[model samples]
Target chain A: MKEIVKDIRRWQKQDKKIALARVIDLDGSGPRLPGAAMAVTEEGEVAGSVSGGCVEGAVVLEALEVIKNNERHIVSFGYSDEEAFSVGLTCGGTVHLFIEPLDW
Target chain B: MNRKPQKDISIFDRVEELLNEEESFALVTVVKGPPVGEKMIVFPDEKSGVGFEGSLGNSDLDRVVSRDARGELTAGRSGVRNYGESGEAREETVQVFVESFIQPPQLLIVGAVDFTAALVKIGKVLGYRITVCDAREIFATTQRFPLADEVIVEWPNKLIEKIGQTFGPRDAVCILTHDAKFDVPAIVSALATDVGYIGVMGSRKTHEDRINRLYEVGVDDEGMTRLRSPIGLDIGSRTPEETAISIVAEMIALRTGRSSIALSETKGPIHD
Candidate 1:
């Protein structure tokens, strides 16, 4: 979150709606910790990260969809999910993310 | 910065300020429970919070997360915690992520020796704020240790007196001076602080003589017990760079409360 704060503020000042995705939990041998964060602006700008370069592309897609639908909720990506989510961590660990707008 | 914003700043405002200033803070959010999205930002400021942008539906959950957030801030850790709907401990209903943004730990080396130079380089890779101090101005120059964040040409005790209060459990003080004149004062002042590691660099005979001198200076048994004389693990490092690695390995072992042995032989949790 600290790493992306600057990007969030920059996007906010530009009046670009920004979505914040934070890895809130992990199981087994995850690459990143719970507070690892990523920010995506409406203009498709990105800052920070939630994984070791894996699953971030999927996260950005989810964030964009969340912004498009004006929705706020939790998103999970891992090898265990049966839904065949477009993104999965290669590390064989679960990553739970909470994504929302920076409106607050 | 754009009219400097305004008063009645939001939590976002405070978060921006704290992040820019590199001031440590914590952000607690009730992620999965009653009142999701409730957020509280806890900065180090004693008088007031930067701001609380949102509230959990339940005040009880907010109170519990706030308390846990401060604890995480102190330890500089981030993790998920569980609580019951009524904020009871050990319950899984409320999932709060206590995220702390703490500055890096500090490492003070008293000697500007060849070993000190190597230690500064290694410590920088580990994200420590390294300070190299020596009474000799020629050795304790930034030119000699460009990797160090600070280089001071002053007696060890005087340097510690200036910044002793800043030494906390995560900080370290290393006395590589070998000579009794600098090592004694360095060890004594380091012992006076809450710094986690106090390492002294010396051979066996040098350590023995220094210990006797320390005893003469009234350093008691309990105080002597904490010093890591002949500093570093028994890695048999012959070069300055290798010795620096051994010293840092010992510091990491002390921080994690792990025995300085092969991890493959250990049976318990690897990171606990």
Candidate 2:
């Protein structure tokens, strides 16, 4: 969040609807920690990252849904739940992310 | 929900303002249960009791979340916590995410030498608030260390005395001044603080001589162990830029208690 605060403010000034995704929890060897964040604009622009390129594309898709529906919820990705989700972390670690619209 | 025209500033505006000011705070948001997306900002306040702004639906939940948020802020951690509606303890009806925004750790380099310039650049890349201090005003000028956050023209010991209390496990003090007159007092003063890493740069001969001087100044065996004389790892770094990398690498290894060896040679967890 600190690293992308400038980008977030810039998009806000341009009146671009944005969605924020933050890694709220992680287990095992993860590339990023809990506070890792990523912000995606409604125009498909991205700033910051919540993972090591493994789950960011999925997170962007989730952010687009969050922006459209204005919903706040959690999304988990990892090899542990490979049966539940197609995308999983290559490092075999679980990461839980909360995606929400930037309206608040 | 319908798209509404933007007219009023939201809580995010306040978040950006606080972040730009480099103030430490926490953002608590309800991610699960009723009233999802509700938020409250918690920070230290002189007037208000808990320094809470905004709400998480109700006052009871606000009070409970604010208290836990303060704890998370102090530890510089962020995660989701479970709670019952209206702040009950036994139930997991509500889940709130507590995101803490902490100030960056500090690095004090007590020598405005050639290596200081390289060090400041590397420290900035590592997200540390770098400060270069030296007794010589000309050497400690900002022009010499443009990357440093602050350049203090003061005696190393005097500067340490002023800001030593703020040093903690995440902070570091590097005594790059080889002169005993400056480095000795700087080392002694740094040892008195809780600063995690104290690295003094010098040769083997200089380290031996400095040990005698340190013993004369009452630095016991325990205090001697805290000092990383002949600073930096044995990376065969001859250039200042490479030496700076070695020094910062040593600092990270010290904090993480790693052996500073090749990861392939080790057989344990790579990260904690």
Query: How close to the true structure is residue B19 of candidate 2, measured as C-alpha lDDT?
Result: 84
- Those runs of model 1 whose alpha carbons end farther than 4 Å from true positions after fitting are A3-18, A27-31, A40-61, A77-94, A102-104, B1-13, B33-38, B44-65, B81-95, B234-241, B264-268
Runs in model 2 deviating more than 4 A are A80-85, B1-9, B44-50
Among the numbered candidates, top TM-score falls to 2
- List the TM-score for candidate 2's chain B: 0.93
Chain B, candidate 1: TM-score: 0.84
lDDT of 1 by residue, B1-272 (tens): 01233458876787778667777878777677656666777554434644333455666665666666767787788887889987789879878777788888899999988999899999998988999999998888999999999999999989998898899888999999898998898888888888999999999999999999999999999999899998999988999999999999999999888888886877754444
Cα TM-score per model: 0.77, 0.94
lDDT of 1 by residue, A15-69 (tens): 8988888888887768888889999987778999999998888888889987887
lDDT of each: 0.82, 0.89
Error of 2 at A18 (Å): 0.9
Q: How accurate is candidate 1 locally (lDDT)?
A: 0.82
